[model samples]
Every structure is written in structure tokens, then in C-alpha cells.
Target: MMIKSLLRISTVKVLILLAGLMLMFAIACGGDDDSAGDSAAAPAAEKKAEPTVVPKKSVHEEAEKKDDSAASGAAATATVAAAKKDEPTATAAPVASSKYGGTLNWGTAPNNNHVFFQQYTPGAGAAWAMNIGDPLMAYGKGSEWLEAKSMAESFEVSPDGQTITFKLKKGVKLHDGTDYNAPLHKWNLDWVLNPDNAAVTRPQISAIDKVTAIDDYTLEVHTDRVYTPLLNALGMMGGMPFSREEYESKGEDHLKTYGSSSNGPFMIEEWIQGEKTVFAANPNYHQKDTYPYLDEIVWVEIADEQVRGAALETGQVDVADINSKSTDVIAALRNADDIFEAKGMAGVRLSHHNAARAPFDDIRVRQAAQMAIDRHAWNDILQGGEGHVYMGSVLPPTSAFAYKVDEYMYEYDPEAAKALLEEYAAEKGLTLPLTHMDAFKCTDEQLEIGCTDLEKREITVTVGKGAANAARAEFEAAAFNAVGFEVTMDIAAGKEGPRTFVTKESSFSLRGFGVRPHPAGSMDSYMGYGGYWNNGSYGTSDAQMELHETLKLAGQAFDYQEQVRLYKKCQQIYLEHALGGVKLANAPSYKFWTTDLRYDGYPDFTEVFFPSDTSLKMYGMYLER
Candidate 1:
């Protein structure tokens, strides 16, 4: 009876201790009488479970916080240097440790016509498209331009400079898993050379007489003459090899909508129209061991320039496109802490006058028009004082073969221009109010006046897009009107001036001339006989013929000094004759990116344009964030 009583008392004491502990736990958890207290404690518990995001402590951070307009240019440059302190300055990957596995968000202009076939599109547009193939050679991989080897392991030109032998890399495969052999290379060359194909790049390689495949890995190229720019032309756009079998089976327009196979470091995964283009890393890439550090690259289309610039500042985008010619844009970028710029190739602005039609067909009129252009005004007003007006022809003033500024002779002299026009009018017995018709619109029978009033003396000038071009068109019209020629402006249907010039749809238009790697490549395309862009028969005059002949001699000369001498002679003749059109100005192009996007392994990172970059710079690039 006593043991039972003791056990009952011990059980009651243990129950009391357990009840006290439960009350203490409830109080710690905020399970009190007040409902607000419980709600606050619940949020505290959830906050502890969330992950933390650590911000990078970079110099760009301090610069971004400071007002950009107040800071001096020296301070801006120093900030850029500091932002790149931990990054590799050279193109090659750094010897230090690297961390990978991130996505790169790039913002760019929209690819209006999304065509993958290089032959159908312009080189700049094609480069912006999904690059799935490799070129024969590429720039930016070496210290100098146009000196890097790509798909071709090695190449040599014969002592005579008429033939070239290329030893292709053996293990390369096309996007469609086809062997990239000599036969494939031969087929591509044949396709381009065929006149029926109407390949846009045919004129660039017109000197090629034949292509012979010695073996699966060896190929030989023979030119009609000593074509020294063969390597540059072959290594540039429209030279990348595609699968013939795929084209034969799937058809030519298949690449317009479908994603093609790629042998490069990255392959197109998906391209949402007007949205974004995604590129996935190639697992079987040739340089898989050390390259393509990013798992994927997402290119977003941001049409608005201001929004694109803001995206970079907010860290929403890694890389972006910035207009290097805009003073406001340049100033804003310089003020921004994290943003940096890499200068690329220069662009030459040209005024194309139709030689096949009236007015421009007259040498006196062409020379007078060329002399009336104010290049300095264009440099100051259109290019924000960042343009080179010393250009003589297709090549920019920066090129080694280009004519010096002092050698240029087309000075702005409206009085002298008027005298030449007056001489032509008096010689032709043409009156001041004589009407000039749009001859291109009329049939052969109605060619005389083309339904135009004979009393009016108006000449139509086709104007391209952009505020600068509009301003130039107005200036040109006023300049022509000052010489007793009534002027009218016709806005171009498309922004493409070359196509309009080739079709002869307009008597006068403004065209953008891209400077080629070699001087001859540009000269042959625009001025050579039977050239793709030589629709107006530019070298028809005896003076122009002399210029063309000099260009040929320059193209064949092996010695650099001899080539320069001949090229200078050609420029002098071109200016004297005013062949093709007026050379306006040369503007610089640039590539912009945030500090987190690192460009390693690209020796000439600032030399080549980003859209058409083929130096395999993307292989060694990575994201630091």
C-alpha cells in the first residue's frame, strides 16, 4: 500500500515539470494572446531561410554613384582602368584561376531580315545572324588585322602570287555533321562564282579563275592575275562554308525560320522573332577544353538606343550597342562608371551619282557637284566632329594605302562649281529653266521629257534615312541650287542605297561604304568592270580607265612601297575625274559592354567590329558576375 502511494506522487511531479517547459516554448515562438505578435514572428522565421546576394566591390561602383557630368575626362578614364583591374588585359585567358557557369545577356539592334545564308544578306547583317560555320581566316586573333588563321590550318601563296594553296584543318565538321573537306570548299567557291547564282560577294572573289581540290584536306586556288587580297576576301564574310547536302534536301529558305547546325563554339538553340536569340555551347567544339566559358549567350533585341544604354547601367544586360558618333551618347557613357568601349572599323560615307543617266553623265557636272560638297560641315554637324574627311575613295584615311589629307583636292568652292556648270550650259545650248526629267521612269518612246514640264529646271536627289543624311540631302540641294540648277528631294523607299544605285531607281543617292581589309577588294567591287556594284559603268571614261589600270598594278605589286605609290596615283586620278561619286566622311564604329563582361584572348579586340567579329573572341570570353 505504501509503494503504490509513492509511485502516484512521482508521476504527478513529472507531469507538472513537462507542462512548465511547453509554456516557455510557446512564448519564444510568439504564440501569445496578440495575433499581430504571431504574424511578425512568422516573417522573421522566413527571412532567415532566404539566400543572400553579395554585390561586387568594384571601382565602377564608386564612379556610378558619382555624377558623371561633374567628373573630368581624366577621372572617367581612371575609373575604366580600375574597373578592369582584376580582368585580363590581353586577348588570351589569364594564368590565374577562373570561375565559369553563367549566362551572358547581350542587347543589340534587331536583325530586320533574319536570313542565315551569307550570300543572300549583307556581311554586317550575316555576322549578326546565328553564326554556325567557320571562315578560312579571321582578324582580332593576332596583333595585326587580317593575320589570324581560322578553318585553314595553314596557307601559302606562290612566288608569282597567282596561285594559293591552303591546308585545311582536318577535324572540322559542319553544323549538319558533314565533313568540312576540300570537296565542300570547292562546291562553295563554284556556287559563288556561278553567274546564275547572283551571289552578292561574287565581285569580291571575281579574280579567282578556278578552285581545284588536290585532296580531302588540300585545296588550290588560281586567280586570273596576281590577286594579293585573295586571303582577305576569302577570310571575310560570304567565305564561310555551309552544308550542300542540307541545302539540297531542306532547300535554300530553310535557314530563314529553322535553326541550322553549327560547328563553332556556340550553336543557335532558339530565335524568337523580335524577341531574343539563344545560343547554346557546343559540347563537341574543337576547343572545348579552354573555351566558351559561358554555358549560353542570350542576345536580346532592344530597338530603342536609350533603353539599350540604360539596360547596361542597371546590370540588366552585359553587352550592348552604342552609337559612337553621338556626342550625348558618348558623354553619357563616359560619365557612367561601369560602361566601357572598344573602337572597331571605320565607315566611309559616299554620294553615288548615276553615270548612265543625264546630268551626272556630263563630266563637268560631276566634277562641279563633287567640288560643291562641304566635308568640314559634314564632319562638324553630322559626325559630332569625329569624322575623317581626308578619305579619297573607298578606303578610309586610316588605311596604309589611303591618300593623305594634303593629297585630297576636292575643296568646297561653290563659285568655281558654278563656273563649270555655266560652261556646260553654254556648250550644250541649254537654258537656265530647261527641265530635266526622271528618265528612269519613262519608256524608250517617251524618254525625251518623261511626261515632265519642259519649263521647270528641277533635278531630283534621292535621300536615305537618318537625320544626318537628311541634313546632307538638304545641303546638297541648296549647293546645287546655288549653281542655277533647281533641286527636288526624293526620299528613298528603303535604307539600302547600294540596291537603289544598282537598280538605277534613283539618279543620285547616299551610300555607306565599308572599308575592306585590303584596298583592292573595295576598289574592284565598286569601280571594276562587270563589278556587282558597278551598275553605272564607273570606269568608262579614259581618265577613269587610267585609274582602274593603276589600281590593277597596285593589286599585283608584291612590294608594299610600290603598292602605296600606285594606289596614290590611282587616288589622284579618281579625284581629277570625280569617278563614281563624292567621298564625304569616315566615322568610327564601337563595341560597348559592362565591366562584368570580359574579353580575353582577343588581341585586336578594339580593331574589329563586334557584329562581324570572326576572331573566335567569344571562345575565350566570360562573365565575371
Candidate 2:
């Protein structure tokens, strides 16, 4: 299921570039070690007697002088080495080896609710679900190709690529002692695919035609057509299996309330809603001795970054995913040698504008809003200079479909923004409200910057509450002018939100969408018809129709050249129609962990297998003694 058309640059090049940038940053920050000593010693120097002046030399004499100068240079180098005895010795403490049987205390941001199959479930909740149950396929840690390997066992795909047959690993059992067999697999697939279930991941498997159990150990899945991303989607939330017995016993409403059963390395021990979730190692895990080195894992819900950092420092939490937006927390973590950071540019931020709503319905107003915010300054201040100014596409430069356009539609120019706002005001004679969630640093800052610019142009800008779904509803009902919100990397790619945004076409809101590895996966969600977050229905323009058609073709096309061409065309249409709203900044996903947490036999970071934060293999991680 791998495509070879994308840019093939190695991770080593990225590492080298990062190293070079760090060195340059250090130098620029006046990190020279010898400066203080040199300054102190310079003032003590006294004038020395001048040596006898030398006359102009012949060619032979000049050659001799050059040889003597080289000798003096070697002598000077030796003298400098001898003078370096006063320098302080630097050393790092060695890390201790991994030891088994200790509880790992992890911390993450809390959410209002936690549900396995819902769209609004938090990232931490999703990570917990993965811990409790295995995806049919798993990607290796830091796998650049996004290769999929069978988590349970091997599988074969039909020649036509319409059918996938899985061979289940023997002797596997769920936490409730139910055998993990073909019937169980078929049940889970049917539940997700069933329209009445309203599974948030239903769109991921919309192409699937049927699922049948051939036997107790084998299952066959048939698709309507060749869907390339089916495996990737299955490797996510859609593939998560829940016990059929529990579903029938407790019913759908209470399944999550009773602590779902686990077929993976860990099982839920306790879940204290809004506080924490405790998991215990499942000794009967199918993977045998490969995982669950730790006896227990306690995931503490700590939304405040500073509080989380303090917990890590005070040995309250063994590992925590600190926020990149919290500069102080990141600084503190970097200062502590016991903490390790796993960093990579995994996502980007974008403002989703409602083109159907007035004010934003005017393309000039949308362009003006985009130009009003200073992304560079936002990156420096909010991300602590760890982010890049984002162009108006969800795909990063690494993606194959990422094409360089000749013109930047909206560069940071407050004067231009002011002119646009003035023109809009003169035409409409109405004040607009700029709203954002105060909880998120990026959106909060964007609202402030945008509002300040509009005010400068003699336009009235009002601030509104920052709730995501609530804001969308209010905007859809025409209760507010504009709302600013932050969209997580996954949600941006998945396109999860209220249906009314597409159905009613009443409100225009601004929010960011993160980057995806592939253009088809990212673009199709926003532009394709029947997509979860397709705001294109808000406008019936020819450009919008062309964008939708191009994106649809790009999603279905297997030919690399055709896919790239179609995606590029779609991007052009999107930009031309000003449908993508405002592009903000792209930042690396920064995860910090204590040095004490160790993975027995896993890479530090896995691009697809591991959760968004922490390098410790979800199952293989152990604490050092």
C-alpha cells in the first residue's frame, strides 16, 4: 500500500539540518566560552618594547620567512593549549539500564468526556484505546515509508486489491477471556461499518463492501473498489475492537462507562473521569514477552502545562507530554538533563474560514484576515521560535503533491489588511466580531492580532468565547460574526465537526487544520463531497465544484503522476477560491519524557505506531531502577 512518488529525502538529512541550525543558534546567542576569560585578561596587557623593524626581503628570504611563520603558528597553538588548563571540565551522567515492575505515571491534558468511537474524543483518550486494544496492522517506530505490519499476524490482499484476508494469531484472548477470533473481528468491522452505529470512523471504511468470517482463525474483508488508504485507516481508530458480549450486556450507552475490555498489552484498571485513568499489564497478552515491562501505567489528567512540568520535576509523573506552546515549560525541560525530547515537524496550523457567511463571504475580507496576522512573530512568541510560517495547504513540503506556487496570496501586511477592512466597512456598514478560544495559545494570539489590525482600520472587532463545537453552533445559527478555534492535527485530516456547517451554510468560522503525510488524505476531507467537514456546499461556485472533483479524482487515482497532477490542480482551485482560509504556522510535535522511562526493545520514536507524544513504546516501556 506504499506509494513511491513522494519526496525521498532521508531522516538523516533532517537531523543534520537541525544540528546545523542549533549550532548557528548557539553562536548567534553569544555562546562563545572564551569571551569572558579573553575580556578579563585583555585589560591586564601592558605595552611591550617594539622589535627591530625588518627591511624588504628578497624572494629567497621571503620563502624562509614563510616557513618560520608556520613554525611560529604551531608554537602558538601549543601555547594556547597550555593556557586552556583553567577551563572547566564538562561531563554527563550515564543513564541507568531498564528495570521491570514499576508503575509509570504519565500526564496529559484532560477533556470533557472520553469515548472510543466519538469524533470529539481527546488525544489522550485515543492513546488509551490503542493501549487497551491492538489495530489489525501496526507501523514500526519512526518508519519513514509508513509501512504496515500485522500486529496480530500476517494478511494477504487480493490481486484486484478489493479484498483483504487476515490470518489471526492463535491463543489470543481478550481481558474478559473471550477468544480473539475471526467472528470477533467481523463483529467489530460490522459495528463500525453499520450506519446506525454512527461510528466516527465510518467514513474511513465507506468503501468496504462486506466482512465475512471464513473460519475461527481467518477473516475476509471485501471492498467496493481499490482503496489505497484502507490499511492506514484500519490501523487507526476504525480498527479498534470491542467485545461483542460486553456490547450486548452493557449496551452502547454504558460500554465505555464500565471500562472496556482489552485485547492488547494493557487493560483498564480504573477510570476516574476528568482525573486519571489507570491501566494494568495484561500478563496473558498475545505478544508474549514483547511488552508490558511495567506492571501498571497511571495516566494523570493535567491540562495546565506548568503544572504538568512541575509534576515531572517533582517526580510526580514519570513522563509527560509538555506543550510546545508553553515556552517556559519547554525551557525548564531542556535545562533538566533527566528529560528527553522527541521532536519532529508532524503538523501545521490553518484557519478554516466559513465562505458562506457574510464579511468572510467576500474573498477580499478573507485575504485581509489572512494578511493581518504575523505568523513569523506568532511562531517566535507562541512556539518559542520552533515553528515555520505555514502556506495555505495541509500538506507539508515533504508530501509529493506539495507544489511551490509563484505568488504568496497573503503575506503579513497590516496596511493591506486595513485597506481591505476599510473597503468592506464602506460597502457593508457593519461591525464584525473576531472570536477565538482563549484556551489555545495559537488561536488566542491569532484573534488578538486580527482584532488589533481591524481596530486599527477603524473597524469594530468583538471577542467571543473559544469553545470549538459551541462556537460552530452559534456561528451556524448566525449568533456571531466569526469564531476562531484550534483544530488538532488528526481532526484536521479527519474533518470531524457538526453537520450543520455543511448543511446550513449560515456561519463562517476560522480555525486551523494540521498537516497530513499525504495530500489526498488531507485535501479530500475538506473539499470532497459527503466529507465530514466539507464546507464547500456553502458556496456553489464553479471553482468550488472543480476543487471537489479534482480532490475526488486525486483520492481515487493510484497512478503517482496522475495523483500529483490532480492534487496540484485542486490546491490551485482552493487557493483561487480562497476556500482554505488563513494559513498560520507549522511546528514540530515536541514530546518530553523522563530519562528513567526506557523501552526494552523499541526505537525512540515511531512515526505511525506510537501516539502523538512520548517515545516510550506504549507496551514495551519500563522504568529504570
Candidate 3:
């Protein structure tokens, strides 16, 4: 299928249908607003940032068009960009018209997984944890997605590209009053790098060999190799500082529930799981001269899309994240007056095949599974025809190196898939109604609640608590079963998170991967040899090995054109060889905030949220009223 045709959507018709159908529902669901908490921290001493106009066009779309050049330029100039000590990026003075204080009630879905253990949970708790901590670097200003100074005041890369020396800002302290210095930064990186921790983002920073603190405010990072994406990795969650003192004293269990010290703009004030998380402005925030305009930011859990939208419409909540799955609700929000909306590519949903076991171990089986999926139907069913583009090995269509789905993906062809599966079955002498055994484990709580049938003859899949996952599982089961296979989907009845989803014992499973800072990140995380995410589906085939090698070369390449060329080759290799799983579909993320809230220098939500941190310089944000 042509990439243009795949992305073609009747935007006018979709908007019209959604607005006409869901407008009444949204209006009727409006309810009373929650009470705002009192401000404890005194007002910031510094002036607000200067007012800047935010464009209507999605930054994600613009990024897709500009990244090819930006990424190449960064890579080409890596060696020439000498090491230098510089001051932190300054925030210009805020406009006199801007007002300063109000609670920002944000709406989002509830997370049932581990809280405060960000390295483990990619769900709700992780979001809160990110907001609690801060990172070393962040996405640069404007639409370009390059790394810039954040916590680390300045940095200089060694001429060889294997080491990075950082100059940390002085006088910064965590919520518990621990010094936020080079030693603390090294400790944080070590925590993430520890194999026993099993941080979900470990692969992103795995290239780092070690970190050395040259002094209280100076640190050096040594990588195992050239590791081109190191800076980008540091700007993400893995590089966020975590206090070693708290971990040693408070213990992991205690910190997991009640957060530790924070060096970020916000500190955790209260957390009532499944209900809400409230964060107060950090009085000792490093950039105290100007930020965290809001007194408190509350993340209220409203899993229902319609109600979440209604909350925003009725002024109950100042901001809410709209899931594209609920097309009508999002459409209504988009058409709503006096609301500012920022859109970005969230991530892609793909089926992660278990290559460690049969039948996914066979390339033909993997290829057949890929061909069996009805991408268009799945997209419509999951996203309500929101016009999300199909994803490839590399994603978001905005990474420095990305390709059209057709260039490195299989088209939906159930007939061919059925033929291939039949040939495979005949060759392997397999029988109908093949009993697939999924290795099942139970949590202690689940076991206490009477868990049974720890092992079963079905393809076990884990998903959220809703109709969406069930429908998706059904669609997937029907597709594969129709194409010559007796696929019985055993929805894991206990946990509704990734713990069950990532197990290698399942006959097969579906996993959703979020957007990464770089294309090499996407490649290595899912397809690299012995990659952390590539757990069950270890890519060991000759073609898979070649793809991994190509990725390594691309990671080390300094020439912009050479990097692009090598990445393209990596994509071609992924296309020719089914790397662990098949690319399915992707979705767009939308951020909606009421007109009452004003931002002085509001960064893109994609940048803030994607890193799974509160990179928002909230000090610049305030309520007009």
C-alpha cells in the first residue's frame, strides 16, 4: 500500500461525525469541580519567561519533516563541537500581563501497577515519578528535537565521542535536602544501569560503560562505544537523578509508596492510588528565580474519556489527555471553543512475537502472523478511524531516519498467510487444535486471592481493564485462527499490566512500544541482540544478526549522510527479515488545556511526557482568573 494512501483521511468528515454524535454526551457529563489545594510554597523570586506564540500545527508533524536534517547535522558536527563550559539556557522575562497562581487539575487514566517505581512501571506511577524527579538534559527550544541543558548547566563531549564531561549546576538540592551534585548523578545512572533493577529503559542507556564523578559538580560519562544517542538517552527517564541516600535509608518498598526527595520543580505532596496524585511546587527548585507558577498540580484519575473531556469542558479540570481510542470525545474536544490543543505522535502498537518458542521461532510463522493482521481494520477498531499512520521498524515518521510502512513492512494478505502457515504445519507434521501452553505466574496478592491453572493451553495476553483490549485480542485471535491456526486467546485474568504481557512462555503476545528519542533507540530496544526488551524474542537469525550489526554501525557513524544511509540499510534489513515482531499501527497524542491557563514558555507535551518526566517549566504557567 502507498504511504500516501495509508495516511489519507477525510478529516472534515471525521470531525463532523464525531462533533455531531458526541457533543451532547460531553455536555451532559459535565459535573462540579474538585476543590483546589492551598499553596504552601512562597511565590517564586524570579521573573516569568517572555511570552512566545505556540503554533497551531502539530510539533510532531513538523518534527517528521525536519528531523532528517537536524539529526544529520547533530551527528556531522559532533566531533567539531568542542567541549566548553557554559551557563544554563536562560529564560527571558515574562510578560507583565500574566497572572501567577492556581491549581492545575490534570485528568488521566488510572494505573494499577507499581507506584513510584518508575523503572518498573510504564503506566500511571511512572508518570508521577517522572514529575517528581528531574533530568540532566531536555529537548531543545523550538520544534527541533535535539538535547539541551536542563539540570546539567553545561557539557563538553570528548573528541573521540566515547566520553562526555558535564558541569552540574551548584546549590541545587533534592526535596530531602541532599546535594544534587556529580556524585548523586553518578549514583542515579548506576541505579538504572544495574542489571538487577530491570529498568524498562535500561537498554537506552546500556551503551554507557561507567560514570565517574570528577568532583562535587563535575562528572564524566564513559561509553562502551561511540554511542551516538548518549545525550538523547541522558535527557530521558533513565538519566533522571534518584537519591541514593533515600534508597539506602527509606528502603525501596517505602519509597515505592511514598516518594523520595526530588530535585525537580514539583515534589510529591500526596498520592492516593487509583484516585489522584498531588504535587506541590518545589520551594528549593534549582531554577527558583522563575518557575512552577502553579501552587499545586493534581493528576486526577478519570479513566472514562467522556467524563475526562467533560471535566475540561466544565472547568473542573484545567487540562486533560484525550485518548484517540475515543474518537468522538477527542473530536468534541478538538472542536470545542477557547481550548488550546497540542498534538504529537504518542507511539506504536505492535505484536511482539515469542521467538524463544515455537511456532514463532520459525521465520515463516512470524511472517505469516505479520501478513495475517488486518492493519486497517485494527486501526479503525482501536482508534475509531483517527487516521493514525501505519508504523515501521523505525517510528513516528519523524525520527532522523524513518521509512514508510510499505518499504519495510508486510501488507495484510490473509490468503498468503494461510498458505504459508499450512506449508509450515505440513513440514513440521503438526496437527489441528495444537495445544499451546503458556507459562503463567501469579502475584502474591493474586495467589492469596486463589489463583489457579498456573499453566494453560492458550495464547495468554495481558491488557488494560476495558473493552478495548478484549476487542483487540479478539480481532487478533480471529485473524490468526482464520489463517490456519487453532489460536485460543487466554486473557491473563490476574494483572492488567506489562508484567504478564512480557513473559516469554506465552505462545505469542502483543506489546505497545512508545516513541523513542532516536531511531537507533527503536532499533536496539526491540531488535538488538540480547536487548532487554528483546527478552523472549531474542533475534538470533542470520538476518536478525545482520540487522543488529547494521544498527551498531549506524549508532557509531558520525557523518550525517553516512548515518542516514546506514539507518536506511538497517530498515531494509528489518523489512527483509521479520525482526521479532510485526509493525501494526500507531496513534497520535493530544493535550487539551482550558483558556484560563496561560503558559509563558510551555514546551511540547511530547517532549515533557515522552521522557516520562515533568520537563514543563511550570513556573511560567498561571491562571488568568
lDDT of candidate 2 at residue 314, scale 0 to 100? 86
Estimate, for each residue in 353-393, the C-alpha lDDT of model 2 and write its tens digit. 55544445566666666666676766675567775566543
Model 2: how far residue 130 lies from native, Å = 2.1
lDDT of 1 by residue, 1-625 (tens): 1112222222332222212111110000000000011000000111122112112121111111111111111110001222333433564434335536678887775643554555444434434332455566543321122322356666656656677777778887776678888888888888778866656667778789999999998888899998665665675544667678877788667766655554566777777877887777776666546556778877788877777878887888887765544567656765787676664435456667655456666767776777777878877876676655644534443344444422345578777777777777777788653237335443444343112112222456667555555776777777667766666687655645444434544544666555454555566666654345543443255554555677677677655445545555555555555666776766555456776566553333432233222112444567665
Query: Lowest summed-lDDT stretch of 10 residues in model 1?
Result: 25-34
Give per-model TM-scores.
0.75, 0.68, 0.77
155-250: candidate 3 lDDT, tens digit per residue: 666666777787778887888888888988898888888866766667788899889999999888999998766665665667777778888998
Ranked by lDDT, the better of candidates 1 and 2 is 1
- Each prediction's RMSD to truth: 26.2, 17.9, 16.3
Candidate 2 residue spans exceeding 4 A from truth: 1-99, 115-120, 142-152, 357-362, 396-407, 418-511, 514-522, 534-540, 560-572, 600-603, 606-617
Lowest-scoring 10 consecutive residues by lDDT in candidate 3?
26-35
> Measured by TM-score, how close is model 2 to the native structure?
0.68
Clashes of each: 6, 7, 6
The model with the greatest lDDT is 3
TM-score head-to-head 1 vs 3, winner: 3
